[model samples]
Target: MAINSGSDPMRFSASIKVVLKDGVLDPQGETIGRALKDLGFESIVSASSGRIFRLDIDAETEAQARKIAGEAASKLLANPVIERYEVEMAK
Candidate 1:
């Protein structure tokens, strides 16, 4: 496969947040919430577990960088079945 290195390359950073889709059971999150409650943090309502990925890519524009990062998240970082991912550009 050929790589596209734009003539005017700018480094961009992206953050990918992978989380369980709503209505999906998260055993780890439940455990954490319970633990927090047991630790005397009674005000805690709920907790959920998720994964974050930080990636840096060379692109010509912010849109291109976001597309690359989003593709990576969809194809490898996140499972489409029970999980969803959100991509954001880092400042």
Candidate 2:
């Protein structure tokens, strides 16, 4: 849970992006990249895949919302062993 300094939080938006860790194998991304090349897309040399989750949150403040969203990202949105996550908040 996020530590709140006050009550009656405002609504905010949160986004969680989950991507494969560095040095990890991403079969889906690799296959997509190959397909792009086979389709005469030479400019697409490095194509990677990731997951994005957009959520609406209510918290006491932006900081609290960020903290809560980050915790959710780590625990539910991403796999700690093979994937990394980043959480962002929107107005």
Candidate 3:
């Protein structure tokens, strides 16, 4: 949790990194990387794709912001069995 003080209402931005759980194959990322190589884009050696979500929320406190973001992750952003999520918040 973070605390911010100023005249303006506090704003929190969250960055979420969603990745395939260890042992889960990222075939889509691999396939895209392979395709890029085939098309002569040799600069791309590998691809590990993931999802990112940027959110804007208003909360009286940073703890509340974190709690809300956590609930969102558990309910919608992440697949419990095959995906894991990391959350970062800025104020």
Give per-model TM-scores: 0.91, 0.88, 0.78
In candidate 2, position 66 carries an lDDT of: 90
Model 3 misplaced regions, further than 4 Å: 1-9
Error of 2 at 35 (Å): 0.7
TM-score of 2: 0.88
Residue-level lDDT of model 2, residues 1-91, one tens digit each, is 5565555779999998999999999889999999999999999987889999987888877998899899888888899999999888876
User: Which stretches of model 2 miss by more than 4 angstroms?
Assistant: 1-7
- Between prediction 1 and prediction 3, the one with superior lDDT is 1
The lDDT for every candidate, in the order shown, is 0.95, 0.89, 0.84
Supply the global lDDT for candidate 1.
Answer: 0.95
- Residue 91, candidate 2: C-alpha displacement in angstroms: 1.6
Better of 1 and 2 by lDDT: 1
Model 3 Cα displacement at 44 (Å)? 3.5
Determine which window of 10 residues in candidate 2 has minimal summed lDDT: 1-10
**lDDT (C-alpha) at residue 15 in model 1:** 96
Ranked by TM-score, top first: 1, 2, 3
Q: Give the C-alpha lDDT of model 3.
A: 0.84
